[model samples]
Target: MEVHPANEFYLQTREIATGNVVGCAGALEVVPVSQVRLPPAPVLDVHAYLADVPYTTSKEARRAVTSSQNGIRGDAGVDISDHGLTLDDEFPDEFEEGLVQEIYRRLTRTSVSDIPGPEPESLVLGNLRQFFQCQAGEIDFKWQELYGDVVRFKGPFGEDRLLVSDPKALQHIYQTSRYDFAKQAERREVSRLISGRGVLWAHGHDHQRQRKIMNPAFGPRETKAFAPLFSDVASKLGGKWKDFISQSPNQESVIDMTKWIGPATLDAMGIAAFDYEFGTLDNSDNELGNVFANMCVEVFGSLSAKDILRQALAGYLPKAIFRYIGDNAPNHRLEQLRKASAVATKVAKELIDGKVEALEVGKGKSDVMSLLVQANVSEDESTRMSEEEMIAQMRTFLLAGYETTATSLCWALLEIARHQDVQTKLRHEIHRKEREIRERGDRGLSASDFDTMPYLTAVIKESLRFHPASPSTYRETMKEDVLPLLKPITTLSGKVITELPVPKGLKVVTSINGYNRHKDVFGSDSHVYDPERWLVPGRIEKTAYVGVYGNLLSFAGGVR
Candidate 1:
């Protein structure tokens, strides 16, 4: 139930204290609904903000640009790396950023009638509602269909934003040039608030360093080793459900699967990732569970105007202003966000030292957390991760891994229910596979065993396509670049272009669902949930280097 405040998903802390500060667990800080006001983006003075900072060298210039965001020395000073997005890294570092911002302002303020998109509902709100549909839920596929693969929609305060699903463009954006486009500054700031400077928060070299060390523990080999742990969690969940049914006098009850599924995934992540048991499945750990559930309800459950404005401001406002709102703002959503994170932070701290010690003594469990601990203790001192960074990764995995897995599983189950034939077919395949394994004298599925069943794999892939956990990823251009398109389209001004020229600071939305269901890629029946599509050879068109699996953008390429 814990919602990630990353893009309406993650919230990183400022002045993070390593020491535990105990509060009333799951306590609600009630604030009047009317007290919440739409925060205006700060119109900061360029010269005044930059005047006092030292900028003699290239490094100092970049530092000043990052540090001066606070109208003082800003601390969250990570920069988007020049990794995949083929950004021009040759520019002089010792340059005035104020002039750059002013130029960007003029360009953004100028007319952009070249790109085609739907009209906005309001000048102030822009196409935010349409964007929200794509991000939160109720994806507006009609826009892509009408405006072609690339649509230039309005962002907050009527700034131009691009919604793109073209294959070549996606390749350029996600793979060919990943570092050029990073999770928008606001998204990173929010993630930092929630998890500190973990992999999710770290980008560029920091991200590469963190991912390199932890990648071993998340690979196929490690996953196969933990299959038994997953089986145990599933068995526990099934027993709990059985008890629920038995307690009913009618012996049948309409149970909310979400209520159970959320906690089940939490327990799974706890054991698999950290080797810690949250006991949320049976409702024993209500402190963390209730707090997270309340946060999910408050943030994701409804489209409150207040919460919407908070998220919208993140999209348009400067990082300094956005972080200010995140840290100092008064709202029910933030209260629950802080509370849930506080409780989780307490748990992560409790687990960190033991994980380190266990690994040091060579008695550590081969869980991902332990691997990270081992990595931290690596002989290469320069590459080792700090305990704080380790803690951030733990929190990152929980927020990113747990709810997302449960939600996807629930979606898979829902899809199965919707199509009875698929359910029956999937069940038959699973039974046959299990029987085959048992006949070989094996008791249950290993992670490798599951891979051998083609149909089950298809069903899972289909579910991922149909209900991608992350519907879309928000990105910002660090520099001006041309996005090449696989399919060309005419602009509003009647110019046919194969490549799109995006200016600096342009906000682009890489549409996962749009690409997943694109007619050219997935065929005319892309919108349909047909697992048989995978069964039929050549039914799906493969786009090179887009997603981590099945040519889908679910595992979004380019975290930076």
Candidate 2:
């Protein structure tokens, strides 16, 4: 049937159920079929849409629709329209109650039967765009009310699509490598923009290889070497805050902690991760550092931009263009990336040259760059990294090692400032650790001390959980298959959905925020700011569990 593109009914049939034909023959007759029973339409609890439903044009739409309706309404007793028929007449005094009871029964049954409902005919692109336009604060409230950590909603614009927000489902998705769920492509695009072709952006064996190369740098010895650096950075920051408070005699000055902490973190990562000087400790406005700082801010802020610009194009813009437009356009991201690439490449080249010079001069070095340089120089042709790859790795180090830690630190401090008691306890722990170290005649607190600081570790874990820097990760289906999970969901539109016979290239989102805050695993107080949750026996407890943060999917997970 030739359908009107602008008509809602027409679009619903075409977009939601591609093979279903919905047409008007001169307003008097609905042609071709004497009777038409569309799929039992999925209902959305929320006013907005964000989930997506799969669509296909090859299926016999009439049979699929009939099958879905039968699943929802039951086959033996109900007629087609009666599938979604309200109980208004059945129980006049409690009509709504009866209808709700019927729905709940259907949902429960469907959940067990593993039958997905029809694609939601209601959720459209316009509705979704409007949903996004709503204030983020209001959206948060809406999400809480609709899902409340356990509810399911129709995907933004898909047939029989639903988004389940239960902790058990989240845990199942996170833990079951067999299902092979992954993050959405939009998130990957963001990762590529920030981290380039490093472990964060790579997949499968490439990701594994990169992780192997980088894993040594975060080992016990290397991590211990960085404790002093962390202490130094934290101490300097505390001192700076003290000075700022002291200067505010009237308490009129309000510090933008995010601003200060961002740079401080850049500085810390430089020393701790690469043994390079960012000079943020001295509050020195180094040219390269400033550029780096600005670049980070720009990419994050681009979340609100309207234009969709390719990341490559944004990375290649001239520095002058970035300086002129600032963070206003997609081009700004490109320019920032370009500058970062240049700066990182230059540093890598310098490190390589320095390693060569050091070898000639007969000196040994222990820093990460030195190790990487030595490895690269000594490797045979097959294993050796190109200069470009070396630079990419260095850039990845700077991007991944610094920003996340800094963001986490910022959130931790913010939470502490808000929860003075937690702050006081943390400080006491820090002081006690320091005293113990001094009593042992240790010049500095050892890495063991950092590990032993229970409250401090708890504080860090809680902060990471509450305000994850990378709130989501993306992955794509490598093959079509059924995904088994703890909770089975029936789509709004009916279909037997399992590992969603997902086409090979379909994108999926691994929502860190949603997974971390799920109530089933975390308890009813999942939303509360409680560091005690991370502590067991007055020490930071490590256990085998599935989550988005601790043993969670905060970092990407896959076969490789």
How far off is residue 249 in model 2, in Å?
3.8
Q: Let me know the TM-score candidate 1 reaches against the reference structure.
A: 0.77
The lDDT per prediction is 0.70, 0.52
Candidate No. with top TM-score: 1
Cα lDDT for residue 73, model 2? Answer: 21
Please list the Cα RMSD from the true structure of every candidate, rounded to 1 decimal place: 16.8, 12.5
| Candidate 1 deviant stretches above 4 angstroms | 1-112, 133-139, 301-306, 315-318, 377-382, 558-560
Instruction: Please give the range of 10 consecutive residues that has the lowest summed lDDT in model 2.
Output: 49-58
Q: How accurate is candidate 2 locally (lDDT)?
A: 0.52
> Which portions of model 2 miss their true places by more than 4 Å?
1-193, 242-253, 302-305, 308-330, 359-366, 378-383, 493-501, 536-544, 547-549, 556-560
lDDT of 1 by residue, 338-376 (tens): 666677777787788788677767788777778777777
Alpha-carbon TM-score of each model against the true structure: 0.77, 0.66
List, in order, the clash count of every candidate structure.
22, 25
> For model 2, how big is the CA root-mean-square deviation?
12.5
- The Cα error of candidate 1 at residue 41, in Å, is 39
